[model samples]
Target chain A: MQNLALETVAPVVESVPVPKITAKDVNVHYGEKHAIKDVSVDIPAKGVMSFIGPSGCGKSTFLRCINRMNDTIPICRVTGDLRIDGRDIYEPGLDPVLLRARVGMVFQKPNPFPKSIYENVAYGPRLHGLASNKVEMDELVEWALRRAGLFEEVKDRLKDSGTSLSGGQQQRLCIARAISVRPEVILMDEPCSALDPIATAKIEELIDELRANFTIVIVTHSMQQAARVSQRTAFFHLGKVIEEGVTDQIFMNPRHELTRNYITGRFG
Target chain B: MSVLYFSLLLVMAVLAFALARGRASSGARAAAFHSRPNYHGLLAASLVAIPMLVVFVIGAILTKMIAESQALTALDPALLTDPLRRGAALREIVEVANGRFRGNPSITLQAAGDTWAYVQRVARFSIYGLGLAAGIGGLMFALRSITPDLKARNRFEWLVTVLLMICAGIAVLTTIGIVFSVVFETVRFFQKVPPMDFLTGTQWSPQTAIRADQGGSSGAFGVVPLLTGTLLISGIAMLVAGPIGLFAAIYMAEYATPRFRSTAKPVLEILAGIPTVVLGFFAALTVAPLIRGAGEYFGLSVASESALAAGLVMGMMIIPFVSSLSDDVITAVPQSLRDGSLALGGTKSETIRRVILPAALPGIVSAFMLAISRAVGETMIVVMAAGLAANLTFNPLDAVTTFTVQIKTILVGDQEFDTAKTLAAFALGFVLFFFTLTLNVIALAIIRKYREQYD
Candidate 1:
């Protein structure tokens, strides 16, 4: 009787349009444990897509796959097709370093280097040779910080330690650092989990404002956070995505029992 | 003998009774309870033991001395007129009284012998009296004071804690006492010899006039030569050890893999465990000859007992001191900093050179300072490899004598203690202590300041 009801309701939910990043039969394994099963999904370009799941369900793993950050872990192994803008990143001769420059990341915990705020934002640009002179580098730093909404608060203390900022400010500093390189895609792994509620709201507003410029993929534990910040939501359980669609329809009317139970607070 | 033994038994019996009474009272609950059963036992034991041990030890020593003195006083007047003869007569009398000597005695021997017998009787009686008093007093005290509420455990713990503190303070006091003794004797030596002569005179011959008619050599006591020799040898040691030890520490902490580090660190530390005497012989026989041969090839004249040989060997002996400490401090730097640098696309070597080395600079400085101090105080290597002549020269190929070498030479064999030559050792010791103490204090202050900046 429940199967009949789910079948009748599934067609009423409209699927969101797929993005330029498409993963076909992607699998990730850490030694004997399969972290991500065979999964296929497409992330839309110039839009915010949030990966929401219970803890240890590989939401962060799927997000890391976009930037190839899992290559840093010695024991992790990834197989199958992964492409960005129809170019296969896993192909031979694709340097992870250059790929990471184009697809930047922000960690869950704010990890600003123990250096001046100017140095922290200028590090990526200096490495990639993005600016021609000192004046150009200064302009780029100010532009990135202003876009991240941290220029007004920290404009006077450009030479102060990056760690001297508060938790919310440090996270925003990390975001400014990512944007300084002008990456095509920004992957955030629970960027606002460590911040207070007010800081979280500000970060969510920044995400909505960022959707017009670049693709943003966020992994969060809060389903409401996904609803507030993302245009599309992908729900994962036990290393598999049960359902994904427009954010409002997934919340008000989910096809899978697990997704409905999770949204309605019946069980997670 | 039976009365003394019975009194001891009575004391033990009273202690057992008190413990049993305390336990029985505790079982009644409410207002009857006062203290734990174990507290009662300890209280009774302390009361019985302290007084008895004190009285027994004191009485035994006093009684023996008094009895022997009285017997000596009763010798005949003629025998006593000659002090040596009277002393011999007293000894013989004691032997005879103790049943070790037997002979027909003259008037002096008879009188001495009669007094000795009386002394023996008095001694026996005194021992019995002391033991009886101690045992009875202990039992009465225990019976009066074994209350249930007494905090015996707390008092016992307090006593133990005080004793531990006293033991720790004794070590510190002993160091201060030694320093004061050396300073006092050195001051006395300086008073007899003019301070200007001791400090400025280049020739160090410390003889004096043996008699009024005979003029002895007026000795020179200048310390410039000794100071020069010490500084030259220590400088050579620092030259040899500093770079090698620091490089080895860097390699072990930053470059070596886990398997290599585990194997190499222990092998390096084993160099420190070898006895200094063995190193002295190796330096004297092997290193000295080798250095001489090398110097001959380069058209330099090197003595068999040159400062180079001793400094090289001493440097080898102190390598573990620098390497182990430097390695520990380098490894103590946080891994987060390393990861942060690597994540910024910096190479591993660049990160270690620019970030890690600067962070560990203060600790490295301290390690080198400690090694330098160890090099300065070293004795066996210099004594064996360097000659005894105090040469005021900086040439490494020449022979030099250090302060420790002079101290050993002056104090060895049969020598007159009152002469300025012997007393100079005390002065040398005082100077060495101050030099090392100042270096250690400066190193500690620098390290503490650096630590504050980071932590």
Candidate 2:
């Protein structure tokens, strides 16, 4: 692999109370192809951090590493010092299953399990044994659905199939499912990418509300989405993080030329 | 004479193709032709071949009728009073005409023979003339019709479509024909033996007494024992195949690496391709004795040829059916469902059991139904390993018989066609057909209901 001689900026973060997740020199490879390379960043507690990039720039790859979702791919390899709350997630003693319980994900496409709406929301809690009785499980499902702002619309048809919901509703259902287990961190991989503008606005609003209780990391292709929803924004280009800073400064006065060109839609 | 006509038709077809292609591609209107010159040529050749073949076939059939009628007319009226005697006389006349008769013939028979030979020659000559005329007419018509605006390609394609339709029709019509034939025999069997007795009686001895005074040979046509025996064996087979096949499918779909799956799937399917007769021999010779020995060692008296042995082998034969169908449906389950469960902190087995299996339940149920039908219809293994006794016992250690085994035993001998014993096979077959058809219909219903769940 030839190393480009472009200017490399350090990961810059403005003052925050504390960082909930941290990464140092993270790299990912799918077989021989280098994907994410030497990227480092800090995600603050209880705030939305968005990674924006072009389609093949490894924003999604790096997002999946938070929950070890990429471990399902047999050929993918990850190397880095990744920690959640000062604990290494990739330590030999850590079980991916347990780590996933504390880190929930919402996919780009609305992927609700082929099950009833109630069951979809309750699935995680059931798996983790969070509820001791039927009443507790039902209450947990309703609370999760209400937190994701999808309870009123789907409350009448709780027994309906999860797939029976509309595109936007299904994504919200997935969000509800993710939060049913009450994870500390939530990762959204372009969750609003598959929805219309109306649904997208609703989800954006919900993400802002969700930031009060959970540390959220989101990957988006839309620069406006990052500007609107995120407090911190990281711009990735060619498997490297070009710049990271407060969202306002990153969009208004980007230090790196690549980040400026990408944010301004000069080229992506 | 037939060979001469066929060769003449082939030559004419070739000539028609060449002439039609030359005219269609001529410089005068070559650029304006609707179809390529090759299509025009193909259309002309087909026109020549089809009409000529039709004429030749019809003409040959008419010639045989004309020659036989003429030969019969030349015989004396008084000699043709009896139908049997007339048939024999006609045979002798045909034999003499062909110079195969070895004995001396009477005067009238010799004259009839001469007339038969003469009439055959005249009819055959006229048929050849008619066939040639039809071929020439078709060729002339095809040559005149070829022009720049003619849709020769469309016409030829229509002909090809008709040919394919005819081929498909033959397959469907043949299946209907077999069903009707079986139905008719079943009706005859019902006429001789009451349907109630055949369907509801417990006894199944199908031997009819040769004389009225013969003792202990009364035919009893009850089919209950066969039905019970069939259910017992098929039940056992399902018990064995259902779990093994489902587990194999899950292992291949979820756990096994692609390299292992590729090699293991075909090796498992090879069990299906092994001849049931070969499997039967293994069941009778090896598994049966081993089972018996095991039973005796445990202070039990297992039959030398037991239902357990046959059911085990039949189960082996049916495993591929279950696994292959199951593997397909399990693999067809979308990846998103699996991912959703796994991301929720569900263990791999929990995800498979709670989420993936429920999503694929409809398809898996249908696969099991199809496998059960296959086990029900299997015969050779049961025939060899389960003894010829109609023991309606549910115990796997006892010898038993099934519907297919009884059907095979009834049909595999020289016997009078109309006897109740022989016709019973057709009845059993009809019942078996109904059983499998019902199962398949139910399977299709399940697949139709849930096919669109994931998409």
Candidate 3:
């Protein structure tokens, strides 16, 4: 795998790939509590960037900040220069409804709409008017499901409720739902946390394949998971980014004391 | 005497509880026990109270029955062959014993009344004795079982669960009792007036012959007029309330801010708290005249007390049922579902209309069915605003009586109990029961199916 990655990809820092997502001094507040402090990083385009930390370390919160999902929380307030494709997403004129359609999200728990599998995938396209007619919509749904690796198992049962699927299949259905809109960037909040080891492998494999077409940022608790699927890894603790670099380097020679302590299983 | 007996029972129960607690831990300090002392006390108290109450109730019933039989002996001997005459004679004798007999009593009647009073007193003493014996027996048995090894807590909990089940069973038993009583009287009514006529007949004047010679109204017992009137008024009410209430519920559930929702929900509920009789008066005194005057201007022949007047008020009363229940079910649609919809970039109104409504369809439907059942059973408004004319018509401008109103009218005025006119009320009640029960069953089935899908 290392031989293949080294042969196919340039050194991330040396090539200076254009940043697909950039955060400068991002902070989040939930009511009276300051949840996320100033955090800054640049995510290279078209690769998986994993955010790893202990629980309550603001990894998921930071991931949600990308698509403005925190805006739904009435008490939550975000102040930062978080940009995607060189555009400030938190600008006053920015439409979260439109931004959400462009930058999709998949949550830790698989939350499919209480609808059929076909309709679940088609919901995004129909909502944003992505498809002009029925044929285009059907083709888009099948393509998304196939890319999510759920088409073979569910093609015969597309009319069945998405909720009736197994846990891993449901998450794939959610992934299919996210991709059906042809989003530019996808934010995943611990997408594989609720799956078994085999399901987790499937999700990891899909993430590697998805890295080719979309800029993906994933928040995971497992160091091994970050090592396996991510190209660049960021370590967050106490609402601040401690270190970020190539996945192999972050796992092999972490620089910060706290990052080393967390990666070495000494203390989180 | 009952008051004193109940007091004695209460005192014994308290004493038994204390004594059992003392007995369970009566040994030296730090003695091991299977259950807590409080459980022993609770078990003992229950034993002392529940059985004694049961015996007391049984003794009271037997005493009354014996006293009645003894009083029967004071009646005239010839009347015994005819049970009906015997009952009437006993009633008069007992009335005489109370010194409220209308006519002057002869020597034999006065002597019989005296004996009847004495027999009642003796029966009362016997009941008191039996009650005391039962109470003491229960106390002794409970005290004997007050040991450290006894599983008092388990027994007490099991007993409480059984008692709770029995209390819940009372509601089921009472419904069955009502159905049986109505069915019995309805059968008697059917014997006099054919069932086919009652069900299919068009006319519904229930003033049947009270006496054979005095030519009174023979009374058409057709149920169609009242049934149609009920359906018509209820339909009007639903047509008025359905869209308005549903929209109000939608706004409250989907669009209202937290501050507004908390304020508006209870205010909507207060509509339900207003008594139906007051609504009836409002319909009669206020809305009816306004409707009639408006009709006069429009050149429509509207009755003064019309179905429109009754139905409008009924619809107002039913609004809260739809709004409050719809709000609950909408609020209960998992937050995850909402987040999923929102993440798809569906606007607020789009998400609500397409997702929330479809998800909440079953619950909303059940809420409407419940409101309709309430409307069908509503009596006071129809009786006051819609005159009790059993006119078979579909026009809302006409005054029509509902089944409930007819039931009320038939039983209220001066009438003989055995007359077909009065018995017709029971038949009406039986039919009304079937309709409301059918509605409730459908609503429940829908709700249950919904829960199965979600849960």
Greater-TM-score candidate between 1 and 2: 2
lDDT, candidate 1, B1-455, per-residue tens: 44664477556656645754565355446244355565555555555655665566676677557765666676656666787786677679877676677666666556666676886677667666665566557656655665555565576467568768989999999999999999997998797777777667666555556765766566668878888888888888888888888889989998898789999999999998888889999999999999999999999999989999999998899889889998998898776555444444444565577557766878988998999898888888899999898778899999998878888888889887677878888877777788889889999999886665444
Can you write out model 2's per-residue Cα lDDT over A125-171, one digit (the tens) per residue? Answer: 98999999999999999999999999999999999889989999999
For model 3, how does the per-residue alpha-carbon lDDT over A1-268 read when each residue is reduced to its tens digit?
1112222322222222789989888999999988888878899899999999888989999988898889888899999899998999999999988999888888889988878899999999999898999999999999999999999999999988888899999999999999999999998989998999999999999999999999999999899999999999998876777778888988898766667788999766
What DockQ values do the models have?
0.18, 0.63, 0.51
Q: What is candidate 1's lDDT per residue for A1-268, written digit by digit as tens?
A: 1222432332222333656688777899998899987667778899988888778888899887877777756689999899998899889889767777788788888877656788889877887788999999999999999989999999999988787898999889988988888988988889998999999988888888888998999999888899998988888776777678788878988877878877877655
Model 3, position B308: C-alpha lDDT score: 95
Flag regions of model 3 displaced more than 4 Å: A1-16, A132-135, B26-31, B81-85, B92-125, B209-218
The alpha-carbon deviation from the true structure for residue B187 of candidate 3, after best TM-score superposition, in angstroms, is: 1.9
Lowest summed lDDT across 10 adjacent residues in model 2 chain A is found at: A1-10
User: How many angstroms is residue A10 displaced in model 1 relative to the true structure, after the best TM-score fit?
Assistant: 17
Once fitted onto the true fold, the runs of candidate 1 whose alpha carbons sit more than 4 angstroms away are A1-268, B1-164, B193-219
Writing each residue's lDDT as its tens digit, candidate 2 over B1-455 gives 78888899999999989999998999968999999998999899999999989887887788777777787787888767889788898899999999898889878778889988998888788777877888788889999999899999999999999999999999999999999999999999999999999999999888899899999979998999998889988988999999999999999999999999999999999998999999999999999999999999999999998989999988888899889989998898888888888888888899999888888888898989989998999999999999888886789999999899989998897878989999999999998998889989988888777655544
Best by DockQ: 2
